[model samples]
Target: MAEDNFEAAPGGFIPGPISSGRGGSGSTARTANSNTLLSEQDVALAAPQADAVPPVIQTLRLQAEATTGVTRGSVSGGTTTTTPVVVSLANASTSDRPNADAADGDAYVDFGGLNGNFNAGSGEYLQWSFAVPAAGTYDLAFGYAFFSASATNRPMRLEVNGKIWDRLFDFTNTGANTTYSEAVTRVYLEAGTQTVRLTATGFSGPNLDYLEIRSADPHRIVIQAEDLLPAATNTTATTVNREITLPFLNGKTPAETFRVGAEGDAYLDWGSEANTLDIPVTATVAGTYSVTITYANGGTTGRPLTLTYLDGTAIGTFALAPTTAPTAYPAFYGDLVPAVRPADGSDAGDVPDQSGWEGWTKSTLTVNVTLNAGTTVLRLSGAGGAQHRQVRVRAGGGVQARAGRPIRHHARQSHGGREPVRRRDRPCHRHRRRFRCAHHRGLRGCEPQHPLRGR
Candidate 1:
């Protein structure tokens, strides 16, 4: 019931849902595929300048206990302390937690780890102070655990610079109580040290581990479903129930279990057409973009929806096919198979996943649209019943990257000294390549929607 208390700052931004099986630890690294949708002339005209400077992406990781102060609150009686790390991390000393000799050689601040096995009760909080070289919006990731006996959610309120950012924010289960996962959100910060506080909204909250902050990618705009503006009466922001089992790792007796939903256990249930959403997007670079919606449908057929500009100009229409499975664990989670460590112990690049569904199979639908520089609004009207987690708007032009590897946008072969452009959802005469969407047939700068990594 705590989710009913959803709140966001005035004209504010939130985060995606619980991100266990969804992807990496809310990292900015994304998976993209080559798109040959534009002609050679269009490609040459829209390509990035060779001398253009890359945007500086800022990142920081701070241990929870490493904060300037750890205070004990008297509201509900709770305490905080440092405990051994419970989850595997890329930078961790060891991958094994249960069998590890000593806490993975790292310790995390634990809320209520001393006074009780639960989190700090309502009114108790943990605060972190850090300095930023740039003034901009940054994504915040809280590494935590909430494997309660009740299997219920633990809600907390995120405060940035003494102002509430997200009220009643929560996370999905971490598979096991000792295991950990990251819940992400967004906050705009001015240059210099800023204080962030997480206060329990429920009787208690998830255990504290560490907090990671990174400058939001300028080219990729991620809009959380919960952050939709002009909140509709029928729309509800909440989480769903789903079970995830990780791949069978070598030397591990029982494999790890991954939970479903976006990073912060947040999503929007589009109740019906009345629950239409007005989404705000800030594009640093003016151009065409591919808007990918991460969603799930439990029905047997596709869920129809329409995307358009504020003035009612059609951007695209999608009938996302059903992603539900009859089984307890859907094969859709199998998309994460490539992320499993190989037998040779070499890194598999930690590919992010495409599993955002809760119980049902997770899926994505993308539409291409053009925009000018600055902020804009897009309207989304749906037949309803779809669980939308997040929307990612990516720059449309240029040679796209996939799994962090660069690939050619156009085929090697050419015709009449011009690279043949391939239209999405339609087979090309020369290349015979087709993509996913078909609604953007007449739209300029339209391109095929590339699938996410590990899918």
Candidate 2:
């Protein structure tokens, strides 16, 4: 009956033999029977091998019936019954918790709600890590949009790998709804995973955006405006007056001419020929004129030409030479000279002293006469009549002399008897003798008076 009951309990029963004996034999048979029973029990309690492990059994229990929907059920024995929830696997991290609906043998991580906000005067920043296929150049792109209307007042800058990589955008002046997208190519990336970060330095509002990176061709040329004229380092030159002849690169040609001054009273004129041209400039006031010239090959050159008034006389014929082309002609001519007459006590020329003086052509006489600190007189008169010629005399270095009036001095004594006689007791008077009697008396044959006057 026990065997039948044990076999009927859904598991197979163990077989046992009935034994009869006395004393030592009975004890031995009893020990053997006990061992058999223990062995059977041990066989039933032993854990199954991995290959013979039974499939997990799941039992569903209906907890409550919904009034207008399907009945809710609870599952046990390593099975789960819950609503399916999708989670992002790309951004999963080890510190995250698994979702409630995660099943056995399935990997999962918990991700909170996506919440991002940037405040005024605060910049938007992003960080990410990725793996690279190989060592080569990569293209990086960043796309951004304003979150709120207040974000329009902020300025934005993009930084990659702690280096600025795009043009800055001022949100205040660049409009509210403006979208910013930038792309930088030829960024060298290694053959492993790298962490890229985008930092907004100057943004001052709710300005946040997304960043994208990729690979692209590494070979390309970039041209900048400053690179066009690298050889044209000096943009200024000092020149006398407003005239300047700029020596350019051998094959360079002029395109346009421009002049800037304090007032619009300045102008610039270029030569008609192609190469080796002259620029004639004019300005009303003395100042630095910014001159810019555009070349024929779409390049430009700039220089400064100082314009000033002609102050001194410059004499001599200056000729312009022709180079590869005809020589450029001058636009204007000027001369600086005095326009006045002589001053007081100046020299005057007198009448002709010889026959050749009648037809003699008067050559300009420039006499630099220095006087002592005191007053002095210089007489000058034309060799002919007073009305025949005019005289001009100047004082100082470059100042012209004004017209002067002539004055005459009358003599109180005649040319004859100019010397007076001297006496021993009369205080040595100045003598005025009309003639010497020694030579004239002998010519007239007058007898000489003897030493003794009494005879």
lDDT value, candidate 2, whole model? 0.22
Model 1 TM-score relative to the real fold: 0.45
Worst ten-residue run, lDDT, model 2? 1-10
Going through the candidates in the order shown, the clash numbers are 8, 20
* Number of the top lDDT candidate: 1
Give TM per candidate.
0.45, 0.21
Residue 313 of model 1, lDDT score: 77
How much lDDT does candidate 1 score? Answer: 0.47
Model 2 error, position 270 (Å): 24
